[model samples]
Target: MLAPFLIMLREGLEAALIVGIIAGYLRQTGRGHWLPAVWIGIFLAVALSLFTGAAIQLLATGFPQKAQELFEALIGLLAVAVLVGMVFWMRRVARSIRTELHASVDAALAGRDGAAWALIFMVFLATAREGLESVFFLLAIFQQSPSAAAPLGALLGLLAAVAAGWAIYAGALRLDLRRFFRWTGVFILFVAAGLLAGSLRALHEAGLWNSLQQVVFDLGRVLPESSPFGTVLSGLLGYREAPTLGEVIVYIVFLAITVPLFLRPQPAARLGRVTDV
Candidate 1:
């Protein structure tokens, strides 16, 4: 539940921020007439995202047991990939995102021929990327834990993100976005590592992976995952009471590879202050 909540919060805020930037830019440049078209693009993108998620859910319900396991494994792997890529991409682009967005907006409006369509397409692509990423991550989370709490938490997170976006746009709230993203990036890496380990477990269940089946240790009697605190840990950090050798190895290796690179120093760039247009 907590995992889904945080993931959705981050993903929803990203989409909201992108839309806000475009809208702010349009307003600043006195191209406010294009705002309607931007909203249209956002609506279409959102509709597509919802439809895609529902269709996938319906399709998965018909799968047999092993096939379902395979599908879950695939979704988990895809989610991990998408999540990691998004984190790194955001980290790399954060410094110049506003400038790049402004440039894109200018280019969209520069042409008299189908300018509205161009802007609409640009906004659609941006929002849809975030939406699709959320869908896969949500699906993977749901597959791992089939409970009402996960969806409820996700809905709440999205609502909070909407509120945050509006507050930021309205200049009612100030945020330290640099620190926010940095800390959240680290949290997300841990989530992805857990997802990766869970994917391996899913693959084994699907008979696609059979090696490294040895149990590293059994914590079932001491700290069973079914316990309340254990459940929270399981949801947040992918804690398994009787984790296998492969799961532990993969989890550690993923963090070992990603955490340092993410934390390493890079060229100093300002991503702290959002453009107030």
Candidate 2:
């Protein structure tokens, strides 16, 4: 629950910040007429996200046991890709996001009435990217844990995101967004690595990958996954009490590489019209 809550909170805050920035810029630039288009985009993106999730859930209900495992594995891999892409993409654009957004807005407004549709499309795509990332991450987490916790975590995450978004917009929250993204990006690398290991396990269970089916370590005697603390660690950080050598190696190597890359801050550029909070 804590894992999902934090992941969703971080992702949702990002989407909220994007929308807020676009709206704020529109208002400040005396182009508030396009605000409706932006809202329309947000609504459509949300609807699409909900529909996509429902579709996946419905499809999963009809799958056989092995098929379900395969589905879970596939979703975990996809989530890993999306999660990594999002983190790296943000790192590359942390400084230039405002300039890019302003350029997009300008381009959209300069077009004809069709420009409204373009504006909506841009906002929709931005928000949907975040939404889909959340969906996949939640699904992977849910596969490893219980269903009841996922919904609760999602709710908590949404509430936190709303409050944080409001604080950011009101200039009440003074986050070092650069550092925040960097650290969180590093944290997500671990999450993705865990998902990768879990995906491999799922594939093995489904008989899709039979090459590396050996248990490298068995700590069930000392600590079992069913234990309270073990369960907590498993759910939050994908800690396997008895892990395969492959899993441990993947997790460790992932952190070792990703942490250094994330910690190395790039030179900040002076982008135009970036509101400092």
| Runs with alpha carbons beyond 4 Å of true place in candidate 2 | 267-277
Query: What is every candidate's alpha-carbon RMSD to the true fold?
Result: 1.7, 2.3
lDDT of 1 by residue, 52-167 (tens): 99999999999999999999999999999999998898888787788888998899889999999999999999899999999999999888877888899899989988998899
Which regions of candidate 1 deviate over 4 angstroms?
268-277
Against the reference, the lDDT scores of all candidates come to: 0.89, 0.81
lDDT of the structure predicted as candidate 2 = 0.81
> Best candidate per TM-score, number?
1
Give candidate 1's root-mean-square deviation (CA, Å): 1.7
TM-score each candidate: 0.96, 0.92
Residue 201 local lDDT, model 1 = 98
Candidate 2 residues 199-254, lDDT tens each? 88888788897774567888787778888777767776678877777677767787
